[model samples]
Target chain A: MHSRTSFSVLIFILLIWEILVNLLHIPKFILPAPSLIIYTCFSQAPLLLENTLVTAVEILLGLMISLAISIPLAIVMFSFPSVDAAITPFLVISQAIPIFALAPLLVVWFGYGLLSKIIMATIVIFFPLTVSLHSGFKQVDPDYEVLFDLLDASFWKKMRFLYWPAALPSFFAGLKMAVAVATIGAVLGEWVGAQKGLGYLMIQMNARLRTDMLFAALVWLSAMGMGMWLLVGKLEKHFLFWLNDTKN
Target chain B: MLRVCDISKIYSDLAVFTNISFMVEKGSFAAFLGPSGCGKSTLFRVIAGIESSDSGHIEWEGLKLLNLKENTAMMLQKDLLLPWFDILDNVLIPIKTLKRDTKTGESEAKRLLSRFGLSGFEHYLPYQISGGMRQRAALVRTLLFDREIFLLDEPLSALDALTRQSLQKEILRIQLEFDKTVLMITHDIMEALMLADKIFLLSHLPMRIIKEIDLSNLPKPRYHLDFELAEMAENIFFTLKGELINA
Candidate 1:
């Protein structure tokens, strides 16, 4: 029902955009009609897909790298208060800075390669993942800890059985946020200095007065982001199946 | 036999138990009855070795229970069924957590759960079951620990009246059949009367065992409607009310 409403609203907006472009005599360089953008997307499918795949790789790799670093870091921070105390203020300070501002520096350090874009994506996705995971680990009810103690469950056993499961729903919540912003680092890095990706294509298309293709690039970028977000949601549903029945 | 000697706990400046003590004989049912939030749960926690007392010792038989976890199976008021686990897994958690052999866990769990009408729901999550059923599953999980003593912290207090009554019978049967020493905490007056061989009335803040009523020789299959039981419950209620009123 919600998707139907969104689809109808999109169609209505596209129809209005198409009509207004025609009536106002809007040139292609200024604002291409939605239909023209769609046409450009179809005509330039191979070029668009190639760039999209590059960006897609950067995004996935970025997500994987961030997951690797942030999850363990979150675990460490959760397990040791001294570590958490040392790192948490720094984490907060880092988040306070505008992450995009570091794109030029990242490109300079990692070069104009996939590494730069992947790092940028990782940066964009790291804080929320770490903070949410840490908080989830802390969410172990004191009572449940008592239960584990009564069972004489080892620290590793508690982590594997209790803490990990308790942390998952919140971790997935962080994952959703991470996936949503996972594209930011890749696209920004491409804009700063990259050989390939939809971000570079958009920049190039913008320079050559290819506004239609620019819009097409945007369509693909948003589609990638949405795809990732939906995939994370599906994974959460698969893993945290008990969440639905938990309210009882 | 379980002996709690000079057990006292205080949180900061607040006194929870000054020097509380009680005893439960082997193969007997004991209930600690008090008003809600009267530190009975805290006392159980201390007994289970999940928490420590400011001053005390708990002895099992003739030996000091340095590690209370090895001897006691506990069920909490909330069921504590680990919502993420299936009914069967929840039942087997103690064995797994204690690193016991799981080879025979499935059969034992199935048998216990079947006894509680939870057989078909083995794979179902706790949230999918009724509250009473989940509590029963929790009881089954506690039993699977294969311990001689059961420490139940108001295990049936969250259920409906009928469910509470039914579970009371189940607990009593389990105690008799397994020959387990069961120490339960409840605020319900008649419930203590119905189930326990001895009921200890408690008063908090330097918590004291205000009264200990021994019903070991009381007729079996005691019911709420019994004239003798009602009088006893009334007397206990007044004693609790008097404690509350005095404060």
Candidate 2:
């Protein structure tokens, strides 16, 4: 019921937008109708697909890099207080610093290639993953700690059996968050400096005043982000199957 | 024997309990009963070594238990089962924690689950089971921990009257059949009277064990009835009622 409402609301908004643009004779460059944007999507399919692939690569690579670093970092942060204390300030500074400013620096150091884009997305993705997972680890019931402490468990064994599974729901929450923001990082990187990507294509089209094509790029970019988010949701439902089972 | 000696806990200059001490003989069920917020739970935590007392020592089988001791299996009112884990896996938590072989623990967990009337629900989550069943699963987990002593913090108080009665029987079986020493903390005078070989009635804050009722002289399986049971229950009730009035 809720999803149906949302779908119809979206359709309603697009219809109003198309009609207003056409009825008012708005310039296509100034404000392309949704119909024109949809037309541009099919006409420039190959071009959009190529740049979509580039941005998609950046987002996926960034996501993988973030996951690789964050999961272990989260585990260590939970295991060792000293590590948590030492690493927290740097983590805060990383998030506090704007990605836009870092993008130029990233471009300068890693060049206007996929490396810089991937790194850009990693910077955007890392904090949420680590913080969410760390918070999840912290949220485990103290009763379970007594159980572990009584068993004379080593930190690794506890993390493997207890903390890891306990923290997964929140870790997936972080991953979904990362997937949503990852496009921003990838696109922003391309906007700052990139040889190829949807952001680069959008920038090029904007300069040429191809507003319909620009909107088409946006449609695809958003679709990619939405697709990734949905994928993460699917993965979460699959892996954290017990959460749903518990709700029943 | 599990012995707590000169145990005390003070918070911000207020005494939660002072010099509280008790002993439970091996294979005996001892209930530490007191009113709410009388620091009964704190004393239990001290014994379990989950919380450090202001000054105390707990000796289990002649070894001082400074931190968490492997000799005791503790359960709380909440089952504390990992909700994400199925019944069988939740029961194997101690096995997983001790880094023991799962292949062996799995079969043992199955046997125990079947014994506890959770035979077909091995794959069910905690929320899927009834509250009584969840607690029973937790009991199975505690048993699988396979410690010589069980530290229970109102482990069955959350259930309905019917379920609580049955679990009381289960606790008795654990002590009598398994021969594990049990030190349980509860507020219900009757619950203590029924299962505990000794019931230690506690005072209000700055709590002390004001009275220790020895039920060991009574016959096995007290059944929550009998003239002596009512008499002792009434005795402990008035004692706590007097304390409540005093407070």
Candidate 3:
């Protein structure tokens, strides 16, 4: 029932757009009708789909790389407090450099290719993952620490038996945020230097005063973000199913 | 057998307790009863080798126990069952971590779960069960370590009254059946009287064993010994209250 209501509301929004564009004589170059955007998407379906795939690949690779690096980094930081103390200031400084300022530098270093975009996404996505996971590791109950010590558990055993499980929920939360932001990071990186991505395609369409095509590219980007978000949600549900039973 | 000698703990120049000494004979049950903030839990941690005292020594069967391999299992006020683990997995945690090869211990855990009325809930996570059930699972986890000595720090204080009573009875049954030495800490004088063969009453702050009472003469089926136990509890309370007055 909620789905139906949302679908109707979306349709209603599109209908209003159509009426305003045709009856009010709004220029197509300024604000294209939803139908025109949909028609442009269909007509340029192959190019649009290819660019979408490139952007998706960049986001996925970047997110995977970030996860691989940051999770172990977090575990290391958690296991050794001095390491955390040493690296935390540098981590903060990394985030302090604006992505806009960093994007062109990344392109210069890595060139106008997937590498630069992937690097951008990694830089953008890693902070939250590391911070969230570190906080989760820090939040392990002292009582459980005592229990672990009493059991004569090894360091790895403590991490496996206690730290990992304690950090999972927070890690998933950070992953969700990373997924959403990763797409934007990929697009931003592409905007600065890439020759073949949805972001570049949108820029080309805008220069040609093809607003409908530009809007169509934007629709694809939004769809990709939502799709990745849903995938993360499904993974979270699959891994943390016990959370649901407890909530209810 | 476990023996603690002149164990004193201080933090940042403030003494938590000092010159505390006690011994637990193999297969005997000892309870520590004190008001809140008496550092009973800290003492338990010291005994379990989870913390170091400023000065003292602990021996388990003639082995110095400070920073040593803990042959003791400790249970806390709140059931610390890992939220992600099912009852069976939670119970098996210590064994899995310690890597002890003991099929007998595993079977003993299973038996204790069923005996304590957690028979069908083995696959359920800690949050899926009630407080009492979770505590029972924790007890089984502690037992699975095959420790000769069990240290319980207010293990049932979080339960509802009825559940607390039931679990207390269950613990007593397990103690008799397993014949393991048990050292428990509690603020409840009634619990001390009902379950303890010997009770140590502790003073506040720099806590020490102010009095020791023997309850071995008390009747079995603890509820039946209520009146006499209540009188003993009152005496404990009087001593504890007097300590507060002196402080």
Candidate 1: global Cα-lDDT?
0.88
lDDT of 2 by residue, A64-148 (tens): 8998999889888988889999999999999999998898999999999999999999999999999999999999888788778
lDDT per residue, candidate 3, B11-66, as tens digits? 99789998889877777789998778879888887777777878878887788757
> Candidate 3 overall Cα lDDT vs. reference?
0.86
On a 0 to 1 TM-score scale, where does candidate 3 land against the true structure?
0.95
Model 1 TM: 0.97
Clash pairs of candidate 1? none
Kindly list the per-residue Cα lDDT of model 3 for residues A140-221, writing each as its tens digit. 9988998888877888999988998888889989989998888878988998999889988988888899999999999899
- For A1-248, candidate 1 gives per-residue lDDT tens digits of 99999999999999999999999999989999999999988999999999999999999999999999998999899889999999999999877878778999988898999999998898889999999999999988887887788778888899988999999999999999999988887899999998999999999999999999999999989998999999998998889989965642
DockQ of 3: 0.75
TM-score order, best first, reads 1, 2, 3
Pick out the ten consecutive residues of candidate 1 chain B with the lowest summed lDDT.
B64-73
Which digits, one per residue and each the tens of the lDDT, describe model 1 over residues B70-96?
788888888887878899988888889
DockQ of 2: 0.70
> What's the ranking of the predictions by DockQ, best on top?
3, 1, 2
Query: Judged by DockQ relative to the true structure, which candidate is superior, 1 or 3?
Result: 3
The candidate, 1 or 3, that scores higher on TM-score is 1
